[model samples]
Target: MLEQGRLGTRQLTTLTFMMVVGDMMLIYPSVITSYAKQDSWICAFIGVPLGMALMAMILKLCSMHPEKNLVQMARSILGFWPGTFFSCFYLFFFIIGASTHTREVGDFMTTQIFQYTPIRIIILMFVIVIGWGVWHGLETMGRSSELLMPVVIVFIVVLAVCLLPQVDTSNLKPVSDTGVVSISQGILVSIIYPIGEVVPIMMILPYAAKQAHQTRDMLIAAGLGSLILATLVTISLLVLGAFLTQHNIYASFVLSQKISIGSFFERIEAIMASSWMISTYFKAMIYLYAFIVGCAELFKLKQYRMLVLPASILVFGLANLVSPSITFIVITVVPYWVDWDTTLGIILPGCLLLIQWLKSYRKSSVTPNNSQQ
Candidate 1:
């Protein structure tokens, strides 16, 4: 069993918000723009409901066995063999996801900030910081997020305000030229990338403080985070225009580069970069924490921290090996990541909830007959 940790509703909210908004800073606007053109913000708006629906399903599963995390609940509802198998799959999924995140940080730094620095050095430095955070445990991570997320938000709002003078509302004109099919594709990508990926948050839910309502807290956080992302998308579309936004790999970073508040406050991309780094660190730490906790529970280990170092090492190695080029990562995340995340995040958990409901209904019906006898 995973040890119970007391994560307050506020901490959980910040953590969820940070996790969903972090990586979206780097990749989301560009990809969504590619699909929806000037109407990319619409994709983000449409995705919110789908994301909430997925969260509702995972929350239902958690409600069925509030005492157990996703891994343990899987074992309980599916029997040992199948449960272990699925739990291992989740571990692998988190590990790969974490690795990709690590690589993304390295890629961003190497391309935009440290062009001459070795990618491996960037990845190692990032993973080391993340390892330290994971080692400190969930309460520490939660508290850290609670403190840092507000600062990140402040920076984002400041950056947006500073760039307001540069925004061209006409850039967002002629909306939906991409038609319904393309807009739907953008919506799917939006849901998968940040919103639907909240599935992994299920691993942390069981550790929340006793009085906390995990489902309500997560749903609210997810909604708020999605709104923030949609707003950012609208800002990116207005400022960068669809053609520039779609082509740039780091659209937000490029947008930040455009900020020049009367020539005195130029080169504000550093602030945006700092915000991305902090938020991405929180995301990597959360994913790493989940992976370690899941592995410990899978094997019934005494402590999850014991696996942290080896896992970090594994993640570091895989980060380097995952793709030879940043373009490959971007090219694959759309169809590939959407499919992968939808299966694990939505379908599998939804199935578990359905099965658990059926089992409960049958048990209740049988109990009445037995009592009558």
Candidate 2:
């Protein structure tokens, strides 16, 4: 392992917590509402347990491999070529995830927040900062997550409380009318978007100081983060209603607009933007870190830092070219992106777990037969 820093348990939990809350903060409610309408909060209620169960499976796979990160374990367990292909699959997933997320921030910033700035410039600057952070390495990002988590928590509480006056409880009244099918679809989407996204943490799990409580720590963090997200969804549905929540790409951003205490606390949507910005920062940094680590491990490089600058350049270029426009992503890309996230997040790790179990079973069976012979 080129990276030797150990993350404290708090740092590990913070990273897992951020995984569930990060970029999903702005878009999760909208996607869920689009699928389940008035029952979006119900979908959230259902998805948390499923997501935690998925986390447990990922943890089991990691434990089976001891200290090996995902890339190393893939090669070791699946054999050289198969593991190499698997490793490449994850590498692509990481860079593409980082690129797409950077594009999102660029689009939001240029169209909504900084209309005067060019998208390319905004993306370039964001990539530079993320690269700088990744260059400093895992420990710094771990600490940064712990620092940013409270900001996210406060932003959620503030948005929910301040928007209470505008919240129309009736907006959620037509619930369950969306039915099991739609709610199930919404749960699937929400599970993968932010909740299942914790699969990337496998890349850095070994960097954390191993604790017997690692599983508990992650589950608690994931549960807490999902609770925060579900609260955001409920608030959005109550305040913005299903139609507006579904139509608005930044539903939480729009929800923050309705926060009016004494009618004077208006236009402070900066709270939403800043909270989201903090989350997006973590998402991009972790994905980029994984991409760099995966590449070095794949090629047997001496150090991962050598790839950081060049990878940032590639990420910036890809961010600009990710889609024809933000509308394309909103309408055409997202439906497919959810499935892709699940493939990387759940299916891949699940396969790793299965393959390792098969190998262990074979070894035990063979030993028993050889002893009898």
Clash pairs (backbone) in predicted model 1: none
Candidate 2 regions with alpha-carbon error over 4 angstroms: none
Error of 2 at 310 (Å): 0.6
| Candidate 1 local lDDT, 227-262, one digit each (tens) | 778888888998989988898989888888888876
Best by TM-score: 2
**lDDT per model, in order?**
0.85, 0.88
Candidate 1, run of 10 with poorest lDDT: 209-218
Model 2 C-alpha lDDT versus the unseen true structure = 0.88
